[model samples]
Target chain A: MKIRVLVSLKPGVLDPQGRAVHHALEGLGFKGVDDVRIGRTVELDVADETSDEALTEMCEKLLANTVIENYKIEKLG
Target chain B: MAFRSAVITFPGSNCDRDMAVALEQVSGTAPLRVWHGDAELPEGLDFIALPGGFSYGDYLRSGAMAANSPIMREVIRAADRGVPVLGVCNGFQVLTEARLLPGALMRNASQHFICRTVGLKVENAQSLFTQGYDAGQKIQIPVAHHDGNYFADEETLDRLEGDGRVAFRYTENCNGSRRDIAGVLNKSGNVLGMMPHPERAVDAAHGGTDGIALFEGAMKALASA
Candidate 1:
């Protein structure tokens, strides 16, 4: 099975990189860029028997810091 | 009685020697050098110093790999017994990553590496690590890193500040650390994780000896205890 994990800073956490990107986009004359938030995507290949619980455990344990970031799991056929 | 200290050198640790030297100079006894793979730390260790460096090449996150090293299990055990642990620069990252300390070290807000001496305000004078300095006293310590920005939720931050766990604050805001926190202590006040390199500021000729008091404080307190 193919899995995709999207990890992002929780809302209300200050993201300097995202802010800078927002600024750069506005500078490039791209209007309506209210704000930008950054995140990371990781793709993994795992045994098809891997259940949703295991993937959630992976996110909570190491994929994302629960203290500051949140992660979503996506399974691709 | 002379103090017994140990400096743990994880693979890729560059400041282990400097930390050992600083401890030796202040305590008048050389610190035992321990490697990460070692299963045991020397018995009767009065102090443990986790020095800075690119441990495990910052894989998975700064200090993530090193925090899980064989040595850290021992560190966690030692800390639970109240042995004083000081983690500077990269060592601070390890402590947080290991869950021995709260918060996480995020990339610099400016997305640039910071390197230089910055003024630090001593916030808690009662912790074993900060007893040498007066509360609210500002001192200089050199900081160098790209991932030194500290992040924690507001509730956790309030608890840390309310409980007087914050050890040091950056006066100049060199990094986009929330609330300009430069260092913090564990709830027990026995473990400290600070980004500034106090080991680098112990000599008068090294620009200033602003950081000397921290070492002396540990030695004196442990000697009397």
Candidate 2:
């Protein structure tokens, strides 16, 4: 099974990197961009029997820090 | 009896030696060096320290990888048993990642790696770690990190404050940490996670000795226990 995990800072958390990128876009004359929030994608290849619960556990245990970030697990195939 | 302390060193830890030296200088005994791969720590440890450094190259997140390493499990166990654990800089990140402490350390509001001496107000001097300093005393300590900005939900922050778990607060708000928190003690008051490098400031030759009191306080408290 192919799994993709998207991890992002929870809303209301200050994202300095995303803000810097947003500033850079404005500096380059890009307009109409309201905001930029950065996140990471973690692609994983697992055995066919990988369960949704296991994936969620992975995110909760290590893939994402629940205190500041939220994670979404998607099954690619 | 000599202070039985240990300093856990992860793959990229750079401040382990400094932490060890600081412990030895204050406790008159060298701290045992433990590797991240180790599953068990030495017995009867009086103190455990996680030093500052780019552990695991700061991959994924600062202190994230090292927090899940084998040794951290033992460190967490020790903390639960009331052993004093001090995590400095990167070590602080690991403590949060390990869930031994609350909150998360995010990128500095300035989005730059800050490296300098900053003023700190001892918020709770009753902690085993900060008892050497008077409550509300101002001291200078060195902070060096990229993701040192501390973040915790408002409710948690209030609880920490209400319980007097906040150990230190930045006098100048150097990292934009919520409530200016520079260090926090766990609910039991045995574990402390702080972004500032107290070990680095222990020697006057290093430009300050403000950090020595922290080590001395812990040793004193443990010895009398």
Candidate 3:
């Protein structure tokens, strides 16, 4: 089974990298860009029987820092 | 008995020797250098230090990979037993990742790696690490890091301030850490994670000896116990 995990800073958390890119985009004359937030995507291949609880555990334990980030797991064929 | 200390060295740890030297200078005995792969730490350790560096090359997240190393299991156990642990810079990130400390270190607000000596205010003079400094005393320490901006939810931040868990605050907000918190102590005050490098400031020849008090304070606490 193929799994995709998207990790992102929680709402209201300040993301300096995302803000810098936002500034650069504006400097290049791009308009109407209200905000930009950067995140990470992790892909994994696991046994088809991998349980949802196990995957959630992985996120809580290592894939994402629950203190400042949130993670979503997507099951793709 | 000479104070026993140990410094854990990860694959990319650059300040392990400096930390060992600082420990030796203060404790009067060389600290044991332990490898990250070692599952068990030597018994009878009075103090443990996780020095700063790009551990695991700062992959995934700063200190993320190193937090999960084999030796962390032992570190965590020792911390639970009330052993004092100090984590500086990248080591601070590892402690947060290991859930030994609260908050996460993000990129600097200016998006630039900052490296310079900055002023810090000692917030909690009762902690083993900060007891050497007078409460509210301002001291100069060097901070060098890209992702040293500390972040935690508002409630957690409030609790930290209310409970006197904050050990040090930057005199000037250099990294955008909430409440200018440059360092924090765990609930029991046994573990401390800080962005500034006290070990680097221990010697007057290194620019200042403001950091000597921290090591001396720890030794005094251990000796009296």
Candidate 4:
């Protein structure tokens, strides 16, 4: 089985990289860019018996820092 | 008993030697040098110092990758067993990412790297790390980092303050740390993570020796223990 891990900063945490991108968009003659945020995607391959709970645990323990980031696990066949 | 201090050096660690020098000057024994890939710290380590520098090239985030390194697993285990661990600068970021300490170091509100001597107020004088300073006393230490801004929710800040977990406060608010936190002690008081470089200020010839008292305090406290 293969899975994707999407990691994003928690809401209310400042995102400087995202803000810089937003500024660049505005500078390039773009308008009405309300906000922007960036995140990461990590793909992993595992055995068919890998449990959802175990995957979540893996994300919680090391894949994502719960202090300022949240992660979502998406599985694919 | 001789103090057995270990200084773990990750690639890009520029301050490891300074930390080792400070430990030897104060403890009279050279700190054991260990590499980042090492699977274990020397046994019976009385003190562990994680010095400043751009660990893992500050990729992804400062201290993020090193926090997941093999040596960090041993560092975390030592911390859990009540060993004293001190993380300064990039080391502070590692501690936060490793979850050995609370809160995360965000980019400075100004998004610029800051490097200079700054004023700090000792908050918790009773911790093993701060007993040399009086509560509310002000001292100067060198800080050189861009991502030292500390962030934690209000409730968490309140709990930290109420529990006396805050070890140092920026007298000038150099960064946007909530409550102006310059350094924090773990709940158990066995671990400390701070942005300022106390190790660099340990010798008088270095311009200021205010940092000497901090290392002395930890050494004294642990020596008597």
What TM-score would chain A of each candidate receive against the reference chain A? 0.96, 0.98, 0.97, 0.92
TM-score of candidate 4 restricted to chain B?
A: 0.99
TM-score of chain B of 3: 0.99
- Candidate 2 C-alpha RMSD relative to the actual structure: 0.6
> How far out, in Å, is residue A29 in model 2?
0.6
- Listed in order, the DockQ scores are 0.63, 0.94, 0.90, 0.47
List all candidate RMSDs to the true structure. 1.8, 0.6, 0.7, 1.9
Stronger candidate by TM-score (3 vs 4): 3
**CAPRI band of model 1?**
medium
Best by lDDT: 2
For model 2, the stretches where C-alpha displacement exceeds 4 angstroms are none
Please tell me which model should have the higher TM-score, number 1 or number 3. Answer: 3
Better of 3 and 4 by DockQ: 3
DockQ of 4: 0.47
DockQ (0 to 1) for model 1: 0.63
Report the C-alpha lDDT of model 1 over B182-211, residue by residue, as the tens digit.
Answer: 999998889999999999998887787888
In what order do the candidates fall by DockQ, top score first?
2, 3, 1, 4
TM-score for all models, in order of appearance = 0.93, 0.99, 0.99, 0.92
Candidate with top DockQ is 2
Least well predicted 10-residue stretch by lDDT in candidate 4 chain A: A59-68
Q: Write the per-residue lDDT of candidate 3 for residues B1-225, one digit (tens) a residue.
A: 978899999999999999999999988899999999998999999999999999999999999999999999999999999999999999899999999999999999999899999999999999888888899999999999999999999999999999999999999999899989999999999999999999999888999988889999988988998
- Candidate 1, pairs of clashing residues: none
Report residue B184 deviation for candidate 3 (angstroms). Answer: 0.4
Which should have the higher lDDT, number 2 or number 3? Answer: 2
